[model samples]
Target: MRRRPPSREELDDYIRTRLALIGIDLSVLPEDDPDAPADQLRVLRSARRVLEQTVPALSDYSLDPQEVPPSMYPAHLPAVRQVAMEEGRPAPAAGGSGRPEEDAP
Candidate 1:
């Protein structure tokens, strides 16, 4: 069975909420470990915002359809294109010559 990918905004919300939950869990620790990295959650939260709002985006994403089997292509392409568009880039070019750029060199 196939599962639909969550939209980018939904993912951002989930990450922020999850990070806050982790911070809460850490707060319950037996001692305030002074060595704990400072503003770790804040940095993560900022990074997530940067991801959604920044024009520069990740290419060669791990879940990229280009990396997947043909069978999964029918399931994943729309979300990939949507994410690319949301990040201010066009959807990946279609019908390439079937070789990775580096391999062509």
Candidate 2:
């Protein structure tokens, strides 16, 4: 199913909410304040424009939440290596897979 693109108001609301999540609340600034986040807003607007132009091409696809992989947490590295050693598989190199790059399929 195809979804409608977000309205300008919706995008602005999303951007503001994202900023607030990071502790920057644009709403508290006086409307006339010269230091208000114009540059950040401009960049977000540009990004939104790019998305509006590009995303329609992807609307034919459906995304399943279960198909998305979970993110790896950096803190689990040591434990991951220990588990690999326990299982008799060689531990992965510091920043590479266990296999050499040339050997990877």
Candidate 3:
């Protein structure tokens, strides 16, 4: 026999319980009123769907913990490197030298 996935209500209850654990109370949200538009719940459910699709895809990548992308550069890194070199010490180990603006004055 195959195991069944959780129902929508079950998942929602799980989310509510988890949120409550973190001090978030979903009960604070206004109840669905027949007189008003259903926009709030619709948007919340849409965001949940987006997360469901996004989280798994994001988890697929095996990223290095020490790896830093080339786009992120610390402004003070060059100064640090210069100080290290002046003191007769080796430059610090970092991803891609972490110095995007080394050539820039």
Best by TM-score: 3
- Residue by residue across 1-105, what tens digits does model 1's lDDT show? 233545766765666688687774433433333466545455445666665545223332324345555574465665776787788765654433332333211
Q: How would you encode candidate 3's per-residue C-alpha lDDT over 35-89 as one tens digit per residue? A: 5554335535755664555654553333333354335654555577678779876
Candidate 3 TM-score, true structure as reference: 0.41
Every candidate's lDDT: 0.51, 0.56, 0.53
lDDT of 3: 0.53
Q: List the residue pairs that clash in candidate 1.
A: none
Tens digits of per-residue lDDT for model 2, 1-105: 235668988887777787779998665545453476555556566667766765553532333322442354345555676787798776544342222322211
Instruction: List the candidates ranked by TM-score, beginning with the highest.
Output: 3, 2, 1
Task: Sum up the clashes in candidate 1.
Answer: 0
Better of 1 and 2 by lDDT: 2
Q: Relative to the unseen true structure, what is the C-alpha lDDT of residue 28 in candidate 2, on a scale of 0 to 100?
A: 50
